[model samples]
Target chain A: MNRGFIYDTFNVVQQNKIMLVYQGEFNQDIAKSVLAMTERNLDFFGEDVSVKRKIFNVMVECLQNICKHAEHSDARLREAIFMIGMDKDTYFVTTGNHIANEHVVGLRSKLQEINQLDKEGLKKMYKGLVSNDKGLSEKGGAGLGLVDLARKSGEKLLYDFSAVDHCDTSFYSLLIKISKNKIIQ
Target chain B: MENLTIKATDDTPEVSFDTSGVMILSGRSLPEDAASFYNPLLQWLSDYGKSGVTNPVVFDMKLEYFNTASSKMLLDLFNELESVAKSGVDALVRWYYPEGDDDMQEAGEEYAELVEIRFEMLTY
Candidate 1:
């Protein structure tokens, strides 16, 4: 019996309750598909409606962020990745995309600032940004998505940047965890 | 003034603004560019403010889901209504959320704190 690489990949993905992965261009249509598919699996698992909503929100933020921010400056930057899985009471959403090096430092600082905040701090920050006209970026960014990601998951964002060879961009990967049992104001 | 009605799509929500002062936004809102999807609504509200609307405005927010970008745009929309309210237009926001959906409920509460118009929290 000779199994191929595709079989190995499929086996790996099927290890947990469900492992959904997508890598390529991320547009609004693809984003829709991702949410629909993830929601079906969540429903199959009989997840609580509220828990499913939290995961859905986090996915929306992550996918929308990728659809808007992932640079297509070159061949390498054309690819983006999204993966989601659940184990026990915790679910994880991980995304990887290429971003311009010029924007890396600013993005890093923003993540650090968000990660330092507790639940209440994140809520206050989100409120402040939404209330102040200048705080919310007109481009639909303004770190609002990142703030919601933290607020919804009630977890610090996990991120890393890797330099790309012979390019002015780097691959940025972010991991966020959501717990079904956790609830905070 | 004519009403503004936008059909809902898989990515965006259904928007209804009536001349009778009943506004509604429901369904999912995950547009690729939330500003493009919402800017026209803001303009419509601005126009409504200028028209000297006499009837009270009842905006029903029955959104099932909205992304962060849309959340910000929604605030702008709310503020536009508040501007109209300041000019003596009676405006109230009815924030509707599914029962047991605390996230949606809390979102309504937060938006209430940001705007001048009164808000009524309702559960569906």
Candidate 2:
């Protein structure tokens, strides 16, 4: 909110090649606006249809995850962030949000499990779980989105976590890389 | 039974399911409240099941994009239809995805594997 912080954040985004950065609480309307704005940016860049769809699909999962799982209270979670950046032949879709500390271990393990899979393995797992009703809830699946993100991006899931102050919560961040090249390899 | 039609929004797809036979769901489907958006359609399918429409029923899905939550609802929707198909009723799902988009195609393939009803994959 202050000039110094804004200046520092601006420099960081500039250095990172971030196309759009959003840092706030998320709701349905905000999620829609984020998608719309990102769509406009993608169109402005004249991105290919297939690539744009990939970005949008990842963005939807990330944003909805924030809405569904983030502990919204001030004591529990705060300042969720989402951003997309590009460098050379790769695009980065990143999200950071505060989650209850109790939930962090489960999510981290799930993501680690997803990161371990090769593309073929990921596909098989996705197909296997796509039918199972255990994690397939109305809110979202347990590890379904994470697996799908890996399958679509054809890259490892990059993620990190750090403890938050004054509460039993952790700030979890994930970065997904999508290659612009037609072939994944 | 009454027909069902829902207008599309930026976050939800348009749904047009008729008792006359063809059911179509198209456009984007990433609604935050997927349950609220899709429950009525599920209810309609239940009603259609009871009405016993002997004619062939085709469920056409033409979604451009949907999030994980909407994807689950889709599975629920397909499962409901599977029951209708099992009870001596003719039912099929025409899953259409844009050509060259392997992700959506693979998604359809996964869904096709789960349900017993006849499923078709066609590229637009």
Candidate 3:
């Protein structure tokens, strides 16, 4: 579909209060759109500078994760799916992507570990993981981006997995939210 | 005394370090090749330390997003700074994370715990 169509369609779905969503192929263009939408939403919703930067950072991390880990080898198909929205009290950012069931365990473990940690604990965990001399792993869960997102939001991650086609493939959706007041502060 | 500058890309940020009197690496750093990008920078810091500058060396990291390997490099970088601090030369490390980004702020604290330097969190 065309960019205007996609943007309008997303705009319609999010008309009630304040929201933005995009799907299909995440490239530099999509990244730019995401940035634009975020800035617009911040302006409409009265987001402070620091909060806008935090949201921007979170979106970049999520967009990069989708680009880096999508199961689709096709470059065109890889850069797809992104959404951002904000209502009176909260701003929500969500992205959907395809992945294999085998990778879910690793992703879950990482999220679980991050979810359990308080601010201090997360920092300690991040340090230990980074300092470990074992080196990098091929797949995800190096504890870098995930930790970064968790630290930025200071909110528990909301996520779900839906079976796609057969058991091997699944659609994963992740949501991040920040309170409007907190953004002002 | 060395000057290092690398442009930022979609996945990374610009880096600028000056070793004229103090050692400083300031800017967003999410390089594709974390090790390769940081190796030379770390080497310069090492050499400066070995040169016996005896002056306070400062490292300013204002990174947005860094992968696991990059995180490790940062740890190594700060550890080297800590070593220089112990060697009689004053070492002061400043970490800036947007005030609203608790994650980055906490990251500065984490590095503070692991390294011997006063880590300050700034909202930028």
Candidate 4:
């Protein structure tokens, strides 16, 4: 499917739309490029104030995750890929990154945990996790971010894990939707 | 000892820590590169630890939003400060969050739990 068609399908009411997608090394250079592209896409799509802020927040978290967690040791493949798009109903944020097979079980459990929590439950969990005096393990160090995104979206997080290669280099995708009504036009 | 000051911008936070009596880091910090931005700050805290300043070092952190990488950097910063506390320098770190910003408050609490220093949550 064409990317433009995908974007247009979502733009039922809004005259314009925001869309950004990139596939590259998950390093400082790519992070900056994604940031710039995000800003330009917002301007081109005529994003509202609140949407802008929300998008910025979401991007900061997602891109930073790519930089911090994506399995970049592979000399062969790019570490991460991501997309941010919008329409009248909601703004869509998605990120895809490489994860070793060893990490998948834990990642699945974490997302499932977030998916199972009610708004209040997630809020409390977020508070509890923050209040707990524990050092950052490679996994949970960035676990808070996933919880943060789920809580803010007020929706069940959408995700999928698929094998990218023979040796368990899986590709993980995360999607966040922001309601149009909530945004300040 | 001289005071260190840095103005806040859209991407960076203002940092001002007084070496005289109270050491403070006040302002929003959402920098581009957490490591590069915080390296010197970490060094400063380490240096303060070696200075033998017994007075309580007040660290005021009023951040709106910080990325995960920055969170790691923050952990490093707090770890250094915790070491200072262990060395018997009365270190008091204050995290100031705007009223109703639960995220910042929770973040402060997180640091408090992770570090041994005297950390307080202040709302403005």
Q: How much TM-score does chain B earn in each model?
A: 0.98, 0.97, 0.85, 0.89
**Candidate 4, A25-126: lDDT as tens digits:** 776567767877787877886876556666666777777777767755565544577877666578888888878879999989999999999978997887
lDDT of 2 by residue, A3-76 (tens): 79988988999999999988888777888888899999989999888888888888888787777776666833
**Model 1 CAPRI rating:** medium
**Against the hidden true structure, what lDDT does model 2 obtain?**
0.84
lDDT of 4 by residue, B1-124 (tens): 5667777765567777778646555554545465677788888888888887887777777776676546777888888988888988777787887666555676688678777888888888
DockQ score of the complex predicted as candidate 2? 0.60
Candidate 1 chain A minimal-lDDT segment of 10 residues: A134-143
Candidate 3: which docking quality band? acceptable
Q: Score candidate 3 by lDDT.
A: 0.70
In angstroms, give how far residue A141 of model 1 lies from its true place. 2.7
Q: Model 1: per-residue lDDT, tens digit, A89-142?
A: 789999999999999999999999999999889999999887776634545675
Q: Name the lDDT value of residue B44 in candidate 3.
A: 73
Query: After TM-score superposition, what is the CA distance of residue A66 in candidate 2 from its true location, in Å?
Result: 1.1
* Backbone clashes in model 4, listed as residue pairs: none
lDDT (0-100) at residue A66 of candidate 2? 78
Q: For all candidates, state DockQ relative to the true structure.
A: 0.68, 0.60, 0.43, 0.27
Best by lDDT: 1
The residue pairs in collision within model 2 are: none
Query: What stretches of model 4 exceed 4 Å from their correct place?
Result: A1-18, A43-48, A72-76, A131-142, A165-167, A183-185, B5-12, B20-62, B72-124
Off by over 4 Å in 1: A1-3, A15-18, A135-139, A183-185
Candidate closer to the true structure by lDDT (higher is better), 2 or 3: 2
